[model samples]
Target: MIEGRVWKYGDDVNTDVIFPGKYTYQPLEPAEMAEHAMENLDSSFAKEVKKGDVIVAGYNFGCGSSREQAATCLKAAGIAAVIAKSFSRIFFRNAINNGLPVIELEDGVDDMEKGDTVSIDFEAGTVTHKGNAYHFPALPKEVLAILNDGGLIPHVRKQLGRE
Candidate 1:
């Protein structure tokens, strides 16, 4: 079970808004990048986000650019998961590769408001918020494996027992 307060956002929240391009040349680490997470959209996001806080957004979330830092920043910012109506294809892959679960729901965020306490059961593919339950197709075993081991790197590490 994953539980957290909802931090709602709108559609087409691009990678640039997520981490900004000015800092891209700096090669800042995840922690450094996290300090700027959502700074453009919400300046206080990085400092205010508590561990396990959930991010809910509208369709086409994570659109624009294919930078992996977008996902890295969110994970480093301690986001529990991102439940959106849709996501850019590369962003979706980057998120899963970096250990952040991105869930798609057609109307899930419509009923959610900022700061709504939400709970998700990946095994059951159910999301509960404000007494409303949203269900999705069960996550595949491979996806679960990557998430369970904390992204692809750790999952691969556990598989080989070493690099």
Candidate 2:
């Protein structure tokens, strides 16, 4: 179960804005790079976000670069989950690999507003907001196992059982 404050965004929020290229050579620390997260889309994004807030966006979200920093910055900023109409392939993988839940919703982004409260049940593939329920495609069992274990590396480590 994932529950948090919701933040809304539009379509095609690419990775460059999530983690600016200008800061790519700077550092890997979450805090160091977080201030620049979504800089292009919303200059005040970093300051406005609060811990445990979830980001809801329109189609083709995270549409550029293979940088995991985009996912990293969001996690660092304390975002709990990301629900979008569609996602870039690499970004989707990176998000799950880093243990950040990313859900793909079909439509109705315009119906939601920032600061709305949301709850997601990954196992059931259902999202609840203001007493309304929205359904999404269910992830495969294998993928769910990895997510439940808190990401690929950890899931692998558990399978290996190396302490």
What TM-score, over all chains together, does every model reach? 0.93, 0.92
Q: Which candidate is the best by TM-score?
A: 1
Model 1, 31-89: lDDT tens digits are 99899999779998998999999999998989988888899999999999999999999
Candidate 1, which segments miss by more than 4 Å at Cα?
none
**Candidate 2 to truth, TM:** 0.92
Each model's lDDT comes to 0.90, 0.86
Show the lowest summed lDDT stretch of 10 residues, model 1.
136-145
Model 2 segments beyond 4 Å from truth? none
Q: Give residue 148's lDDT in candidate 1 (0 to 100).
A: 77
Model 2, span 39-143: residue lDDT tens: 888887899988888999999989989998899899888888899999999999888888888899965556778888888887788888888889999777787
Predictions: Cα RMSD each:
1.4, 1.5
Q: Residue-pair clashes per candidate, as listed?
A: 0, 0
Clashes of 2: 0
